[model samples]
Target: MKFRRKHYTDDTLLALYKAILKPRLIEEKMLILLRQNRISKWFSGIGQEAIAVGSTMALQEDEYILPLHRNLGVFTVRNCPLHQLFAQFQGKPTGFTKGRDRSFHFGTQEHHIIGMISHLNAQLPVADGIALADMLANRNKVTLAYSGDGGTSEGDFHEALNVAAVWNLPVIFLIENNGYGLSTPNNEQYKCEYLVSRGAGYGMKAVQIDGNNVLEVYDTIVQLSAQMRENPHPVLVEALTFRMRGHEEASGTKYVPQVLLDKWSALDPVSNYEKFLLQEGILTEAVIAEIRALIKEEINVGLEKAFLDKMPEADTKQELQDMYKPFVQTAHAPANATKTEKRYIDAISDALRESMLAYPNLVLMGQDIAEYGGVFKITDGFVKQFGKERVRNTPLCESAIIGAALGLSINGYKAMVEMQFADFVSCGFNQIVNNLAKSYYRWGQHADVVIRMPTGAGTAAGPFHSQSNEAWFFHTPGLKIVYPSNPYDAKGLLNAAIEDPNPVMYFEHKSLYRSVAAAIPDSYYTVPIGKAVLTAIGEDLTIITYGMGVHWCLEILAKHPEIHADLIDLRTLLPWDKETVAASVKKTGKVLVVHEDCLTGGIGGEIAAWVAEHCFTSLDAPVMREGSLDTAVPFAPTLEQNFLPKYRIEEKIKKLLAF
Candidate 1:
C-alpha cells in the first residue's frame, strides 16, 4: 500500500480495502470461536462486506447510520473500537451497553450508530426521525438506514419509506439482498423482480447494483448522497449479495443449494478484492502479508481484553439504577390569578403551547394535528404559531410516528404525540414497550417524548374508542403514567410530563375534557409528577383514585354531606405517591381504590395489594377496591353508563363506610 493517484488515490483505495477486509477477517475468527463453543453466536457478513464498508464510507462522520445485525463492516469502518465491540459481543462491562445487552443488538451515539432491536424493520422509521431532525435544523446531514431482503416485507418498511418520500427527507434506504432470510429463500420473500422496484412504488428514486463490486457500491453512494444533500430527498438502493455462512452458526444452510454456494465462493469479496489490488499494482505481496498480520494482532488484542474484563454487576441496586435516567429542567413560576377559568382540554392545550414556547427543540407529531387541529382541537392554531415543520401532521402510521419520536429524542429533541384516542395506542404498542420503554434500560437513549392519550367511556364511541387502558403501560417498566382528572392538575401534569426525561403516557379522559373545570393560573407551572394530591379532607374513610375516578368520588361526596372522606388523586401512576397513600390509609383506617379500567387486570388491584401488605393493621375493615366490570366499553349510551364505575362507585363508597 503506497501513496499514488488514479481515478482514486492508491492510499484511499488501499484504506477502503482494509476497512472492507477487517470485518471479514473478524467474522472468520468469530466463526472459529463459534465452532469451538467459545462464543454464543455469529451472524457472518463474510460475502456482504463491501456494501457495508462502501455505503458507510460514503457518508460524513456527523451523519447517522442504522445498520442491520448482519452488517458488522458498518461498525468496523466507522472506527468503532475493536475491543469495545468484542466486549459488547461477549457481555463484558466495557461494552457499549455495559453488559446490559449481549451481541450486536445495542446502539450508541458515539459512532453515529442507532442500534437495532430484534424487530429489524422497526429501525427504518427511526432513521427517518434522525433525518427529520437534521432536515428541520437545516443541517446537511444525511442518514443511511440498512435493511435485509426480508425486512422489506414488513409493514415498517413501507410506512417508513412513505414517510421519508412524503416529507422528502435526506435518507438513503439500502437493502442487502443476501439470498436468504434465515434459511427462507428469496422466492418466499416477495413477488417483485427486485427489492429496488418497491421503492418506485413509493415514488422514490431507486437502483440495483452488484453488491460484490466495492467500487460500484462506493461510487453509487457518493453520487446519490451528493444529490440528496443538494435536494434533500430519500432514495432506495438494492444491493444483490450472498452470505457465505448461515444466518448464525446454529442455523445451518442445508436449505440452500450446494451449486449456488460453490458459484458464490468463487466471487468471495475479500479474496477477489485482494486480487484486484494486486492486479492494479496497488499492493505488493509484502504489504498484503503486513495487512493480514496487523489484523490478526488487533483481533487477538480485542478478544484478550474482552475475556479479561469484569462482568457487569447484576445486583438489585445496579439493576434499579439502570432502569431510567433524569434530565435538567427549567424554572417554573406560580400560576397568576385570572377571572377566566379553563376546562380540562384547555389546560392541556395551554400546557403544550407554553411548553413549545419554552423548549425550542420541542416538536409535535400526530394524525390530523395540523390544519384539522386534531379530533378535539387540542392543538388548534398551533401550526400557525409553531410552523408546520414543528407541528407535523403525520400519516396514520402509529408505529412510524412513535419510532420517529424515539429517534428525535435521542438526537436532542423533545416530541409530544397525540393518540387521537387512547384505545388506538395499541397500533404502536411494540414501539412503545420494546423501543421507547426499553431504550434506557437496553442502552442510554432518553425517551423525552409525551404521548397524549384521550381516554375513557362516553359519547357512544364504543369498545375501540372508549377503553381506559392505562394498565397496559403500567405493567411495562421505564414509563411514567399521568392521568389528570381536572383542569388544574391537567395543566401542571402535562407540563411536568413534557419536562420528564423518560417516556410518559398522559391519559386524558375525553368525557372530562369539557365537563371538568377549575380556576388555574394562567402562567406556566408544573405539578410534580409521582405525588398524589389530597383533594378533600375527612376522617371516616380514604378514597384513592385518578382521572375520571376522582370525579365520581367528588360527585358522591358533594351529593351526601354526611359521607366525609379523604380523597387522594394519584397524579402519576408509575411512580405513585406511596407515602401519601400510606399516610392517608393510616389516618382514616378504612381504604378504597377506584379506577375506570376493568377490575380483573386494572391498576386498582395493584394499589389494593400494596395497601393490604403495608397498612394491614391500620385497616378498620378489609381493604376494598372498585372498578368498571370485566368487559369491553359498550356502544349504547345506557349500556356504556352501566359499564362505567361512576354509578356504582357511590354505592361502593357507602358500603365501605357502613363496614
Candidate 2:
C-alpha cells in the first residue's frame, strides 16, 4: 500500500520549529537547575532534537512511544504538560511519578508513553509486546521504540528484533545513532557498516536517514508508519545524529576532539531547522522572536509553579503496598459440586486452561509452550484448544519472553510467561528485577503478568537445570512470589496469580509434578495471595516452609506424631503470611524456617530474622533455620541428599524439641 507523502505547509514548518525549540529550552533550563543544585542530573538532547520531534510527529496520536532518557523532544511534541515535566525534574509531589523518579524516567499512561530505565535496550521487547497486543486485538496502532547506538550491543536488542520479525509485529525500532554512547565511540560499539542494515538480517524493512534533517526523518517515518498500520510488519529506522553534549551535565566532553565538536556544532539540528525555516520564508524575524518568547515564558512559569509544589512525604509503608497492589478477580464459587483428584502438574494445566477459558485477554508465552505443551506437559493441548496465537512458543530468549510479557500486561492483556526451568530465570533476571519489578514503583503501570517457574531439586537435574531461585526475586520489591506445594493450592494460587495486576513469580516445584495429588475443586476459585495454610496445628513449635520444604516437614510430622508442631505452608514467600506466622510463633514460642535454596542468602534467614525481631519476647529458643549448604546445587544425588535431606530436617526437629 502506497501512502501519500506529507506536504510541509507553513503550519507544519511552524509546528516543527516550535517542537525543536521546546526541548532545547527545556534542556537549557534543566542544565541551569543542575548547576543550581535544584536537580540531581540532566541528560541533554541538545543536538538530536530533530529525531525526537520528527519521529513523534509522524506517529498517530493513539500510537505508543517507548522513549529513552535523552528524547526530550518526544515529550514536547506529545504535549506533556510543561509544569509536570518541571515538577518531575525538581522532584516535587506534582510530578508524573509523584517524585518517586526524576528526569525522563516517568510516563503518562493516558499518552501511551512508557518511561525508560538506564538499561537502554530493555524497552525493545516491551515495544514488541505492545505491538503484538495491538495485532492480536486487530487494532491499527503501531509502536515506536527508541534506543541509542550503544544499546544495540545488548542481547535484548537482538531478541526483540527477532521476535518482532517472526511474529510480524507493528513496531518501529528507532535507533538514535548519536555517534557516541557516553564516551564510547561508534567504532567501539559494533562492526556493522550501518545499524539499519541489521534490520534486513532480522527480516524487516530498514532505512538510514540524516537525523538532523527533520523533514527527511519525518517523511520517512510517516510513510513507514502508514504501511505498518495495515501490514503489521516491524520496521527499523537508524537516525544518524551526534551527542553534542557530555553524557550528562556533569560529564565534561574534554575527551572529545575540538575539530569534531566544531564540525557537528555548525550543523546543529535546532539551528539548522531555524535556518531552513528562514530560507523557506515560513517564519519572519518577528515570528521567530514570538515563538522564543512564548516558550521561555511557559518554561519559566512552569518552573516557578513546580518550585512551590510540596515534596513527597516520608511515610511510605502504605505507598509501597499501593504501588504493589495485585489485580484481584471477583469472587465466585465453583460451577459444580464435583471434585477431581489431580497431580500437581495436571492441576497446574487445569488452572491455566480454566483461566484462558475465562479471560480472553490471557496469553501464554514460553519456549515450546504451544505446540509441545511445555517440557513438563503442563500446557499440553493448550494450542489446539485456544489456538497458537494465545498459546505462543517463543524463541529460547528468556529476557524477551519476560520483557514482552511486561509489555502485553501494560496493554491490558494478562500474560503468563514460562521459564523452561526455574534456574534459567537468571537469563531474564535483568528484565524481571529491573523492568518488571520496578515499573510499578517508578510509574503507576500495572504489569499483570504471571511468570511460571518449574523449580526445585530432589530429581538431581543439576546446577544448570535445578535451582530454587526464589530468593533472588524475593529480595526485589514490587513483585509477588507464590510457591505452592500441593495440587489444590497449586491450581488456586496459579489462578490467583493470573488474575493479579502486579508481576507474580509462581514457582511449581518439579519434585511434586507427579508425586503429589489432591482433590481440587472443578470450578474457578482463588487462593488469597500472602496467606499461609496450616497443614497441622500444634503448641510445641511452628515449622515455616514452602514448596518442596512443605512436603518434607509433613513427612517428618507423619513419621513422629509425638513431636507436636504447627506445619505452616507459606504458599506465598513474598508478603509471606506474617500475621499467621506471628500468631503461630507467639503460641508455640519456638520457630524453624526451612527451604531447599542455599543457606547464606536463603529466605530462611529473612524468616529467622523476622522472628527474632518481632517475636523475641515470646521465644523460648533462638529461631532455627535449615537449608542447603552455601554452594552451587551439586549434580550428584548423594551430595544433594546430604545437602537437603529429610533426615537432616528430622535431626533439627529433635534438637528443637530437646531444647
Candidate 3:
C-alpha cells in the first residue's frame, strides 16, 4: 500500500500519550532533585514534550533516534528506564552513560536510542548517518532527530539537510522552536519566521505544526513518517512551542519575562492535551487525577533507584584501562622497526590500500580522490581499484563533505576524509569540534570516525594554504590528534586509527609528503597510539617535535655532532605519550619543543608543561619551545623560513652546550 500522510487516530494518540507522559513526570522530578542539590544540573523539555513523544512514536521500536540534549522525552518513550536516566543525571555508575557523559548528553544503545549529543546542531548529520546505516542494512527503520530553533543557524544543519535530501535518506528532522536559546529570542537569533522553511532550501518536504497540541503533532508525524519508512526520503517538521523554564538548572526565571510565561503556561502541552481528551470523551477529570498519581509514583521509584546508584569504582576503571588493547607489542623491539624505504606519499597510499583490504567498512572520500588521484595525486587511481562507493569523490562543499563523512561514520564506516588542503579544514570546523570530538562522550561509543587532512607550511602556498591550525582541535577533548613525521609511523598509526574505534583527526604534513621516505612492512601492522619515539639520543638537550619538525631536526642533528642532542617525536597529542617524553627529558636534563603551529597554546606549551611537572627535578635548565611566530605563514620563502623555527637541533644543541 502507498503511504498516506495524516495524523494519528484515537488509539495511536492514547499509546503515544502514555509513553510521553511517563518521561515528562520524570523530567519534573529531575528538576525537583536539582533544586534540592541532589543532582548537578539538567535541561528540561517540560513544555515541548509532544514533539519528542509524537515524533519518536512515528519510529519503529528499534529504529535509531539521535536526539539533542533536550529530547529526553524521546528516550523515555523509547523505553530507557527512568531510573537509568536519573542516575545518568546524577553521574552514577548505574546511569545509561556509565557516568562518563556530560549532563544532558545521555541515552543508551540497549534502548535503541542512539544517544543524546550536547553539541547544538550535530544530531542532524548523525541522524542522516543512522538512516544510511538502516538503508544499507535493508532495514525499514527511520531515524528521527530533534533539535532547537537556535541550532538551525549552524552550518552542520545546512550540510546535513543538503546531503540527506540529495541521497534520499530516511530521516525526519524535528525542530523544537522553544522561543529562546539561552537568552536570545527566536526573532533576534534568526531572520526566518519559521525554522521549517529552511528545509525547503534543501529540497525537502517540510511543515510547521502546533507542537503543544499532542494530537496535532501525533497526527502530522504519523502521516509523514510512513512515507519516509516506505520510500526512504528525508522530511522536516517545525514544532512551534514555548519554553516553560530557563535553559538549564543554572538559569533561573530572572531572564524570562512574566508575560511570556503567563501566555505559554496557559498552553502547557499536558494541560492542552487533557482538555482535548476530556472534550473527546477519551479521558475524564477523575481519570486525569488517577493518571497524575500514577506518574508521581513512577517518578518516585526512579528517583529512589538513581539516588542509591554508585559511581564507577577502581575495578571498573582498571578493567577498561586498555579496552581497545594494542595488537602488536613491539615495545621491547629495537629501532629495527624503523626502516628507510618508500616515499611519504606512497606510504599513505599503501596504508589506504592495505587498510581497505583489511577492513570492509573502511572508506576513502574527498574531491577527486577517485579517478583524478586527488589534486596532490596522493589518492591517484584509488577509485579504479576500490570503486566509486568506497573511494568516492565529492562536490566542492567542504562542510557537505564533512557532514556526509560524519553520517558515514555513524553508519559504522571509518571514513578517511581528505580535505584537498589543510586550510580548507577551517570550513568544516563545526564537524570537527561540535560533532566528531564530542560524539563519543555524548553518544557513549555510538559513533567512531576518522578524518585524514593534509597539512603544514613549507609549500609557499601562502597564508591561506600554509596555516598550521592544530591548536584549534587540540583544545577539544574525546578526539585523537596525530601527526606522523615518517612513512613508518604514518602507515602504522593510520592503520591503528582505522582499526580502532573513536573519532581521529589525522594531519599529514604537506611539506614531507613526497620529500621523505622510509621502510614499511607489507604485512599488516600498527604503531601504538599515545607513543612517542626517541629518534636520536644525545647528552645536551631533548628536542620534542612531530611531522615536518622531526625531519628538520634530523638534518640539523647531522650538521652539529659536537653538541650532543636527543630527538623525541610526539605521534599523538590528545593522549600524548607523556611517559616517553618525561623519560627522554629526564635523561637529557634539558628540553626544546618545536612544531609548525603558532607559539601560543601550541603543542610546545603542552610539552613544556609536562617537562615542568614530571621532568622538573631532572632538568638542568629552564625548558624552551620553538615554533612559528604569531602571524600568518607568509607566501615568500624567506619570510616563511623566518616564521618557522630557525633554532634547529644543532643551534639548540649549541645553546644547550653553553648552558
Candidate 4:
C-alpha cells in the first residue's frame, strides 16, 4: 500500500476517502433494501471499491468515462447527488433516464459518462471514438473505459483494442478483473497468464495493479492518464481483485470456495483504505465516526427523496416520440436551380461531399474509404478534400467502426459509416441494434450518425457481397431507413440522412449505382424522410416499391400504357409515408408490394399487413407481395437474377392491375 510519491494534499486525500466511502455505504444500503424486497436487484462492488474510486479520481474531471454496472463509486466520485442516483435506481420520474431505464444503465451527458450496455466490451470502441474527437481537435483529454474479466473474451474487446492501438487514441482501458464473470471463474475464462499480457498482441502498453491498493491504483492511473495525454495512446490497466458477493444479491455466492473468500475478506478495499488513511494521519477515530454519521444522514435524506418521488407513468405517445429526434435541414437547394442528369452513385458522392463542406462536424469512417476511395469509389476523393481526420480509413472491423461512429456522435460530431456491402453489416449488427439505436431512447444521447449500406443483388457478386437487408434493420426500433431509386432522390435522401439527429440507415442499391440517372440539382437539398415519391401516378392499382423496383414498374407501365397504376416509391422505410400509401391504396383500391429481399419475412409483408388492415375496404384484390425466393443469392448471373424480384416486379404490377 506504500506509494513512491503522493500527488494529492491532505484535503484531496480526505475528499478521495469520502468518494470511496459513500459508494461502500450505498452498496451496503442497496443490499439491505434488496433483502427487504424494496429494490429489485443489486450488483455489489463490495471488495472492489479501490479500482472504481482510484481510477476515476485520478482522471481529469472533464474527461469522459464509461463505467460498468458494478462501478457505483464513479457516480459518487463525479459529485452526482445521491438522491438522484437513488431515484434512478428506484425508477422514479425525476431519475436520469426518467424511469426509462434502471440502476447504472443510463448515461448522463452532464457528467460526461456513457453507461455500459449489458454486452460489456461493446463500449471499448466507443471510448476510442471519444478520444478520436479529442485527437482530431488536438485536446489533451483522455477517456476511461471499464470492463469485467469475462468481457475481455468478447470479439468487441479485440476489435476495440486493435482500433485504439492502430489509431493511437488516448484511452485508459481499465479491466476490473474481479476473478469471476457471473460465477464463471477466471481459471475457465482465459488461457493467458494475465489479461494485461494480451495487450501486447495489440501493441498496447499494459500493466497489472493491486485492486486492493488504493494508492497504487490512483498513482498508476494518474501517471498513465498524463502519459496518454502527452503522447495519445491506449493502455490496458488490469486491477486484480475478488468479488466478495454474488453477481447479483439474489444469486448467492455458494459457488465461491470458502478459502478464497477468507483470503479476500481480510483484504477488503474499504476497510483496508480506512486503515491506510488512519496510518497517514488523514483521519482520527472521532473524524471517521463523524464522517460515517454524515454519510448516514446523507443516505437517509437521499432515501427519503427517492421514496417520496412518484413512479413514472407509461405514455405510449411520448415513448414513441422519444425514439427519434426531429431533423431539420439547415441547407437547401435553390427553388429554380439548374439540374443535370447523373448516375445514382455520383449523386451520392456529390451529396456526401456537399454535406462534409456544409457541416464541419461531419466525419466519414469506413474500410478502404480514404486515399484508395471506397470499394465502389463513393468516397474516392474525400480524403483529398476533407483531410484524413474527417475521412478515415478504418480497419476491416465493422463492429468497432460502427461503435466509434456512435462515440463520435456522443461527442457532438456527426459520423457516417460506410459498410463495404449491405450484408456485411451483420458483423456490426450488435453495435447498430443495441448500442446506437438504443442510446437516445435509453439516455437521450443522440447518435447523430448515418450508416451508408450498399445493398441489393444483380451483379452476381454472390450472397456475402449482395443483399437487400433493410428488413433486418426495419424490424429494429429507433433507426431511420432510407432507400432511393433515382439520382435525385439519392442525393436528397442522403443529405436528409446526414441532417438527421438520430441514427439513419441509408441504403444505396448496388445495381442502380451507375445505371439509374436523373436530373439532380447542383445545390444541396433534403428530401423529407417520411415522404414517398409517386413515380407514375395512375388509378389502376397502388404499386408500392423502392430501390430497383421503381424502375422495374416504370418499364412495366410503359409496355402496357393502358394499365395505369399509382407507382409509389417509399424512399424511407421506417417512419414510412403511411399517409401517402393509405391515400394511394384508397385511390387505386388494390395493393402490390415489391422488394428485392426474400418473400418470407420481407418488408413487403409488413406493408401488405398494413394495407390489408387500413385499405381493405378500398381494395379490389388481396394485397400481393413479390420478393426473391427464400434462398441464398447465387453467384451465377441467371440464378442471382432469378433470386431477386427484379424480373417478377413487372408480372406483379400486371397481376395487381388486372385484379
The clash count of every prediction, one per candidate, is: 0, 2, 7, 0
* Root-mean-square deviation of candidate 3: 4.4
Winning candidate number (TM-score): 4
TM-score of each: 0.97, 0.97, 0.86, 0.98
Model 1: number of backbone collisions:
0
Best by lDDT: 4
Worst 10 residues of 3 by lDDT: 324-333
Candidate 1 lowest-lDDT run of ten: 1-10
lDDT-wise, the better of 3 and 4 is: 4
Model 3 pairs in collision: 6-223, 7-219, 8-219, 339-519, 341-518, 341-519, 373-380
User: Across residues 1-659, which tens digit of lDDT does each residue of candidate 2 receive?
Assistant: 11122576778777878988999988887888788898788888888898999999989977889999789888888888888888888778788887788888867878888878888799999998899899889999899999899999999999999999999999999999988888988889999888988988998999998888787788888889999987999999999888888998778798788988898888788887787778778878899899999999999998888888988887667577656754555655677778998999988999999999989999999999987889998888898899999999999899988999989988879999999998888889999999888888777887888999998888887888878889999998989999999998898899888888889999999989999998889888878888999999999999999988988998889998888899899999987999999999999998988898988899999999989999999999989988887778788999878767466888898888789
Scanning candidate 4 in windows of ten residues, the lowest lDDT window is: 326-335
Estimate the Cα RMSD of every predicted model relative to the unseen true structure.
2.2, 2.3, 4.4, 1.3
Candidate 3: clashing residue pairs, number: 7
Candidate 3 per-residue lDDT, tens place, 53-159, comes to 87777667777777776776777777777777777778787876566665557545666666545557666776776776677667786788777888887776777
Better of 2 and 4 by TM-score: 4
* lDDT at 611, model 1: 96
lDDT of model number 1: 0.88
lDDT of 1 at 538: 95
- Model 2 residue runs over 4 Å out of place are 1-6, 326-331
